[model samples]
Target: MKRTTGQLAVVIAALVAGSATAQDMSKIVNTPHNMANLDVWGVVIPENQVCLPCHTPHNARAVEDGASQILWNHALTEQTFEMYTTAAGHQGGQPEGTSKLCLSCHDGATAIDDFGGNEDTFDNVMIPADRLSNMGTDLRDDHPIGIEYPPPDLTGYNDKSTFTGVKVVTINGVDRVECASCHTAHDNSYGKFLRQTMEGSALCVECHDK
Candidate 1:
């Protein structure tokens, strides 16, 4: 793959930015993200390596446009999405940051065995269409991702700092909500890898005043 000077610069920038964040490997063995434990995809990762399906220590694959890097080992999704838009004119745009990484498997576009440069012989083996985890590419029905958080008016939304469980990702100096905001990939104690329990709408109210 030939990369222009600008593209190389972007990749370098992403590498630097990605290296700053810590990788949380705790509690993933019990989660669905533990591909080796599932064995449904027919990919035999040596020694039941739970992290290899999504991450690698060296030579991780670069995502589309080199937007962000996180030792990403899985094949990225190329599905064009119908983004979410709110009645108040808030646009979710395309998936960004960790959201894109999550979609690598969840979108049902990239095969489950399509990591580590392996041929995708099990292309049919993907997240089941009926499952809620298989969000597919049509994101219009889901909560908005890649959207600026704490709307300019701050109407019906709590201050970003008030969020104790969920988090917002900063993209290009602007704080935005991504999948990681609500879902902590390494931890699933709350179920669904949610940063906090949704019981009594607790997670929803973390950022939403309603």
Candidate 2:
């Protein structure tokens, strides 16, 4: 049976829409699960050695500072990070735990291949020296994290509940924003691994008044 031109147009539209859908995996190559494929995490691990870059099955690297721990396989960065500050003369600095874990890979101080007891799995596997994604030891320009925000009910936000309602990963009993608060490490359901849509600053406005 021959389909009308209008029918073909509709079918094509649907196909295009489906291709752009959030969960479309082909459009998602840089998600954390596929870190080996990223320039920041540039390396070619064996198919079986994927997670070995950041995780391990036995005797994982122990988190040295904070109480929070993971199966962390990568070596932590050595630099003392200059954290974000509020208007009150640079208070509210210092990332807690999970954020530090991300910095292990993104802070541009640690090597992408610097994991598994600092084993050299690949040559020159560190992230490039300079890039926006390569957030250096200085974090003054970035959004504030590791700082306490008003809990449960806050009057500054349009929806005070929205402020506290969104994901807030705590470390060592402190309610602070870590990298994972806005990001999904293994999932790209939202672009750039954001936990929710940032459209119209949808994610920001949820917690801010503006």
Candidate 3:
């Protein structure tokens, strides 16, 4: 079959996008070379089961709170976090969606090895208390999640038109900001595992008006 110029261009664009995605996936930190017995924390499991700690094909949908369909191999966090708030406009709520998945390890509540519905046999790996990555349950000091951005209105959030520019990922059909918005859970091409560079506050400027 002969293809039109537009169709050829679309195919080329898709190939390029796929190549970029594959490249980024290769650079992610979840590889066996990076996570397999690396000198990270004493609590980490020494096994070479890299992605097994967080994902699985079957039985992932067996878990609760709509976690199974996402291939969530890890256990959900049981702790309730102290959520974020602004002095004037506060809309944050309890952790949900991907943010909850991140807290599965980062909140310092759940064990890293406690996944695949088998925490007993797994090594007693956990993010340490001293590490900055251990965000704990209290989030009043951290950037906000589980909240809606200011709506397009006149009196309340009308002044902050630039908020629309901040990156966001939709979950359950609602445009919400989750931890994955700013950070990559698996990718670390950015030195700090951030999704983008922070030089000159470029990442911050993506959402903030200033």
Candidate 4:
């Protein structure tokens, strides 16, 4: 069946609108990750450049051992975290890989505006301690980040090879869970930048057999 030009035009318009909506939903500016838009934190972002705070095209900062450089521009955290040891015998160690990158701002020690090697702008503007985002250096109370997945001896975890929603970072020949495993830095469509929704503990059960 041949369609009229008007029908084709309507179809094109619908496609364009859908594309735009998806773009808007994935934009970092629409999420709290956009440092330039966080005026409530009193952070005076030197410019409107959104990606510059965490990423850069050149002269990027070097990441710690066991982590690959991701054109990172933000300062790395130096705090030593006290990791958690689960009752099931799983133990977490010092954070590495993308998890450490996240802690650069979330540890409540590094300033949110202390990127691009700039020293004069908001040198002390750290994430507020009261904010839930600030996980602080003591990670004993939070979910283990740098721990081995599908624990060598645990029973509650699902097989890592069969996971579809979350990912684990392989650092120094060990596949371990990192901050990026649970959260997507650029998208907040599901809220809290979670890669999946938490309804019915869906996200939690993605890795845990429980």
TM, every model: 0.81, 0.77, 0.72, 0.84
CA lDDT of each prediction against the hidden true structure: 0.80, 0.67, 0.68, 0.84
lDDT of 4 by residue, 52-145 (tens): 8899999988775847688999888989998888787676777888888899999999888888867665547888988999989999888888
Question: lDDT of model 4 at residue 140?
Answer: 89
Maximum-lDDT candidate: 4
For model 4, the stretches where C-alpha displacement exceeds 4 angstroms are: 1-23
lDDT of 3 by residue, 15-39 (tens): 9999767767436444322445555
Arrange candidates by lDDT, highest first: which order? 4, 1, 3, 2
Question: Mind giving the per-residue lDDT tens digits that candidate 2 earns over 4-54?
Answer: 999999999998888667446433343555655664445666563657777
Return the clash pairs for model 4, or none.
none
Candidate 2 global lDDT: 0.67
lDDT of 4 at 142: 89
Winner on lDDT (1 vs 3): 1
- State in Å the error of residue 58, model 4: 0.4
RMSD of 3: 10.0
| Model 1 vs. true fold: TM | 0.81
Residue 170 displacement (Å), model 2: 1.8
Stretches > 4 Å off in candidate 2: 1-14, 17-33, 39-42, 65-67, 151-165
